[model samples]
Target: MTRRPSLAGRLSRALAACVALALIVMVVASTLVMRSWMLANMDSELHRLSQRAGERLDVEDAPDDEVDTDDDSNEESDDDSDDDSDDDGARTTLQSSGRAPRPGGPLVPGGPKGHGFGGAGIAEGTLQYVSEDGEAAGAVVSNFSVTYLNAPALAILAAVPADGGMHTVRLKGMGTFRVTARVVEGKTVLVGIPMDSIDDVVLMLVGVEIGLSLVVAIAAGFAGRAWVRRELRPLGVVRAAAADIASRDLADESGNLTRVGEETTAGPVEVADVAGALNSMIDAVEDGMERRARSEAKVRQFVADASHELRTPLASVQGYAQLARRDIGEASRTQALERISSEGARMASLVEEMLTLARLDGNRALTCDRVDVIPVILDALSDAHVVAPDHAWELGEAVDAPVLGDESALRQILTNLLANARVHTPAGTRVVVSVLRSRDEAVAASAAPRGPAKGGGSATGAQASSMITIRVADDGPGIPADIRDRVFDRFVRGDSSRTRDGRGSSGLGMSIVESLARAMGGSVRLVDSEKGTVIDVTLPAA
Candidate 1:
């Protein structure tokens, strides 16, 4: 199966693009700067060379009678002389002895100005001069007095100048150049220089730029992949941990995953937060598992206890009925009939208690009525006194202690607490029930007692005008600390062996009390009894 791209992949791609773009920009900028610097240096060198060549073309004296009208600052009569010849095969005027030196004389003194005798001076067959007026007698001379260039430089030189216009040219086998000139004193001096060096430098720089761009692209791609991997490592851990968890593993207390553990919280903030969420889910799952287990166990135990409680009476009734049917005397029939009636009555009582538990489990809507909490406690105590005359029962009342709930559930809760106190304690143990307004002792009993040994029999009770609390405690052994929190679970009595109670105590009493109190928006809890287990019942004030 094709997997979808992860965040890491996308992030790496984006980072790579950014890095590549930045590198490209830098390379282009550097290349342009290098090319410009190289070109400028070449141009400066060319200009310097041209200046030196122009210096060499100057003459020592001015020609007379052909005064350059453009500027006449130098005007002197020549005494006598004729040496150089013009293109017409005519002898041209040379510098005479008496002629004044012209202003702006020779750019440099003593420079060559001539045509070859019987042949024109052309450097290496490339540099040549042609006149504008026309060649005279197989000779070409420009109107400008002087011109010079290197024929070997022709291949690298620019295009030949047109009259007075500057032009650039690329020679046949050399690089490009610029050739230019302006007429000075009725003479034209052309200068040209090769640009091969500058062109070579530019080409080299272009190559470097392209190479750097490729290198940068490669480097960015590798860096992007590494960065993506580093950033995504945490998320990978989360995925693996999640996959390891399963439904069956939810109840394994030792292996269960929770957010509060060091492993989950030890990482980066994002990972820690994710771990915390997982821990919360784990906690909820564990609690649900515990509750479900208790519920199922209670259901099974209930079925067993009901069978045991009703079976004895049911069997008795069946036997008595059978005996009555087979008897011939009225006395035997009447005696069997009496035994049947007594068994039926016992079954009836057991049924009533079972029905009460069922009602509590169904979480039916409760009836709200103002009940004096003191009276409720006294009533429960009075019933306990009658049920087990062997145990001592004590009661306390709080002034104006009132509550709102189903009167019957409250009565049952108190009855169950007293009954638990009776069953868990030995005969003649003092069972104190106290009720008081704003009594701190009663409030302390809302928490679970430590245990049957260290935590039992130390239960206390307290009360507030706005909330009523009652405690039923004994002097016998209390609940164990380890299982104290679980005592309120359905069908979970302090004793487990069915043989301990030939008529086993149905463990749903505490469960019924807890469920009923919660349904009525109140709470029932165990407290540390002075010598035995103490239970505290709290309800909303009327």
Candidate 2:
């Protein structure tokens, strides 16, 4: 089973952090903006109140009775006007900044309201204003403390520059406040408004934002889980199909596990494409396997036919040899003994070739090792001389030819080629075995049919090449153009009707050569030649 990453685990963790961070930013920003708006409103209101009070002051409409016109004429209306101005300022202070008189209490305790601009205020925590000279301007002692002004809300107040617009002040140990101080007539006019309403709104906004973030995170996690499952469904189907196909051996004629099911297309594109492609590949493999099975059945029938034909001649030869041995006549005994030996050898050769073909048809592993081609050819020629005494065997100069192959199989290849030449060539015919390094000739030998001439009889002096080739040629009746390709097949011969008279030649030599060459990761084929049959054996050099 294939293990996949958990979608919920990844999505949930990622979304939680993202949503929480976003909500925090939103809360902080909204709170700051709301607090600023509230302070601006309060500052505007205080400015309007000051302007109204300034507009109400009248210079010309001074009380005539209250201003004493003195006998000293130089003390003009200006002197009386200044005295009237001082009185109006004191009364305005008592009305605006003075605390409401307590019942049965003395009013304006500081010597009966002698003031130009004096105000009373409630001080709490860090909410205190300093004048341009840096001295405390308003009330000195109250609920707030100036030392502890580092809280987040209090930091917002400290952030406001002394020269900037109206801003709110939040004390660490006291409630938030909106404070504005401006210079009026060379004195600071300070006004403060509390920010409780704005604070409540900000708190509400924060709660709503956090709740929405949580909802979004939860919804996203659920959606991701649903999407992942839907996307992986087709892959699951494909996985099951592959597992079933691998476990089944469909070579049995019964069509049991051949069918693969189609899946729905409501998933990811990659999964759908994989399933479609896998099904097509499997179908093609199954068809090819079925065709191979039919071909193997045909090969078995052919083998049975060939075995019957070979066994009959052997049985007859053996019976005659037994009778001749029992009679004890010299001539009869000699002929029977010769027939028996020839028949037995022929049968053995046929059996050996047949077994080689059978090995090729089965799952046989070839043992490949480094073998020197030049020496192997020399050894094969020495063996061939005994078998073909009448034919003039010429051994050419040996070249350094190395190959990776089974040594026994390489020798068999040489034996088959020499035996083929001996069987086809006439007595006293010249047979040449040349060893040289030729790149094109080696390639052409493995690609084309065997010829009776060495590399098309064009003795292009040996060229330096990567591969080594050994050509065995004979000046005999060359194979016809049409049957040359089939010469390497089992039971096929140059002249099929002219059966050998028990000389151990069953037309299986070339077949053994073909099979052996293939097992060594090489091949044997006819080289184009004009004169006689020439078989070139090419092997890779070490």
Candidate 3:
């Protein structure tokens, strides 16, 4: 399998490719521009030389001075004289510029040969003179041993319209040249300059551009690699941190774990954002892990406690069953049978409560309906009074408190709270069951003395707008201060020794109340009381 490039590597390659492309484009464009300018200048120079050749031919073709007797002849002779004078003047101008007149023409003051206009190596110009009737007049070759009047080159030169504009032609024996033809004195004059110099310059420029482009591309690659690596250093730190975390067993109890610090999370905004997000995720994961561990521990303890609670009743039932099976007298057998039945019923009740808690833990949806909690509280109070008539169970001023909840779950919550109060309190303790239609604020105020209710309903701004609360308060010894916070925890009994009313209490009563209340979109919390425990159940008012 091929190894894919990393972020830094990809970034570096991309940057280097961009730089190389830009340099290539710039170099190509500049070379093209330079070549165009040089070629244009060369053409201009060729045109100038062609124009000079045309002018020189004009001077050479001028008629000579002479006289005639007839009127027509004299007219022609006079015209010839004027032409001769013009030729003399033009030749004198040329001579003044250090160029001698034609081969047989008169000489004028200037420098010697090989020094000025007639000098060798002065210009690589090949001149050809052609007559109007399509015949070559003469040719002049400079800076070379042989004349460039090859048939192919001559044909190309003769094809020009003598328009004084530059054109390009390739001489069979002379490579390429820029040539221009012009009509002068009944003949066409062609002037050309070899293209070797321009070609050489273009070649040299290409070589330089290619060399520079390679150097720049290589340099950019290295620099981009280094810069990209540095810029992405924070990403590497984040990656390492994640990998380190992944390598560790998060389930371990030890809280010592590596975390990315501000230094690594403080770079570029995007990288910083990623680092911050990673840190937050790790923190949340750690928190969740802790909560999960605590939940598991609680579950384990609950199972152990439940087993212990069931074991005693089971043992008693087993002992009584074995005793009943013996040949005892009728009276003794009947008592043993009764004890067996009682122990069996207790164990069944405990098992049922455990099942209920398991169902609640499974997040079973509760029945949603408009329930009048006032009636539920009254019924619970009546039952509690029946169960413990020694305790003064009084019902507070009843109110029509309608709420949305599961009717059975609501009744169960009330039953548990009232039972917990009656069983835990001393005889003659006034156990008050009340129903009140109030807002969250009023409930909070009344519950303030209790330092907030444990496992209480957390209402949204909208839900807290109104609520229905059921209070089960007793005037017996209130819950111990030490266990107040964990009153709703599973298997937590008011008596830490797990004994209540001279028997082992299941310790799941309060836990069941809180779970049922919450499942019904409500909450159960212990309220502060001066004498005895006050349990309040709050639900969203319908």
Candidate 4:
């Protein structure tokens, strides 16, 4: 299996990647802007310097007749002997003595005009000028003087256009400069500043940006990871809860209902939601386990009850058969034989009820048709009257409650209910059977509980006026509160408190009624009544 990164790690990586990308973009944009701004300032400076130099050249080199017309200002009439500028704001007019300056000579720019260049922090390679005569001159700030350029440097500057627009060019001996050229008094006047300062500043700025961007990206990664993990701390609580459940011993008889703490719900909404979902799942699992435990307990009780019940009949038949073999005279032998046959018949009846319950529990299919419950009630009442003539069997408040169910199953339900009343109550107890047409809510006890579908499943509130209720009630002592809830459970019989009247019951009677009713899309429930037991069976109306 491919190993996947943790949520925290993956999220941190994404955050870091985004930070790095943003920083890179900023660095590139800033570098370009800074470089562009510096070059613009350099171009402006070069333009101003070139114009100043051209003005001076026009005055010193132009012919006497041409000087006045070419001059932008007549200020060039100052004494030629004082060829330098000073702090008094005077600008210089260079002569160069019409020849190249000697190496290490007195500073030619030392006069008021040239001294103007000395202050103001003007440095070596800060200014250079190439004239029309194929000669080059440059200021060496360090030496506080001006010197002629070698032939190669002069040749490079001479090639510059005199259009007065700024340009960058590398000099043959004096490094690179941004320069402009123009004709001044029949001589090409070139003036420029070197490019070294701008290059150094821009380089340092780029270096700083790259280093800062990397630091920010790395810092973002670590900080983001911790924040995300704290926000999702609830997830760890949920995981621990799950692990605790998993570590349990969930055997057949074990019942553990451990749960996660409320702290697990404290976090971001998404984390809280996940923790809440886990709690819900745990609740469902606990409910299922509880049901399973009950079912298992019921099964054990059922097996023991069945064995005890069958053992009684088998022992009786065996004992009587042995007695008959003794030949204790004809009447006694006949009585033993009869007793054996009677016990056999009772056992057969019990087995039949058991088998019927098994098939009903299996959800056996039934053929359904409209059944008028009044007729079935009357027929079952007549039979109960015959079985226990001492009991007062009567029909009460009858209605034409037609239901869609198996006729035989409907008859069986009423028979079982009447039998329970007859056998459990006193001989003179009044048993009344009633029928009514009712709404689903009024008779919804007949509808099956919702779960995995049994065909079309149970009735709903939308099925208004769709239920037929048949109630079998008696005026005998009511069932004890303790066993009333479980009266319909298989093999669960009540004590004498319900006036069971010393009668024996298989206890499967009510369970059978319940199963058959539910199988036919109906339900059975015991109602709280003023007196005696009131068992109501509801079915879907035809």
Q: How many backbone clashes does every candidate have?
A: 29, 16, 1, 10
Per-model TM-score, in order, reads 0.56, 0.55, 0.81, 0.76
Q: Give candidate 2's whole-model lDDT.
A: 0.58
- What TM-score, to 2 decimals, does candidate 1 have? 0.56
- Model 2 TM-score (2 dp): 0.55
295-359, model 3: which lDDT tens digit per residue?
A: 89988998898888888888888999999999999999999999888788778888999999999
Q: How close is candidate 3 to the true structure, as a TM-score?
A: 0.81
lDDT of 3 at 469: 76
Give RMSD (Å) of candidate 1 vs. truth.
11.2
Best by TM-score: 3
In angstroms, what RMSD does candidate 3 have relative to the true structure?
Answer: 9.5
Candidate 3: residue 529 lDDT (0-100): 58
Evaluation by lDDT, superior candidate among 1 and 3: 3
Query: Worst ten-residue run, lDDT, model 1?
Result: 131-140
Q: Model 3 residue 230 lDDT? A: 87
lDDT string for model 2 (1-542, tens) is 99886755576567666766776787788778876786667677655643432332221111222111112332234555665543221122111222342211112333331111222222232133322222112221233311211223322433455442466565544566666545544433344455666678777877787788778767776776676666666777777777888787767632444444555333457766787677777777777787788777768756775777587667868797677869587888888887677776667767767787788757477787888777877788888888778888888766766777889888878887887787776788888888767645434323334333443532232232655666888889888777876777667677755355434456677877776665665556577767897776655556
The whole-model lDDT of each prediction reads 0.57, 0.58, 0.68, 0.71
- By lDDT, rank the candidates, best first: 4, 3, 2, 1
Q: For every candidate structure, what is the RMSD over all alpha carbons to the true structure, in angstroms?
A: 11.2, 13.1, 9.5, 9.5
Q: Tell me the deviation in Å of residue 58 in model 4.
A: 7.1
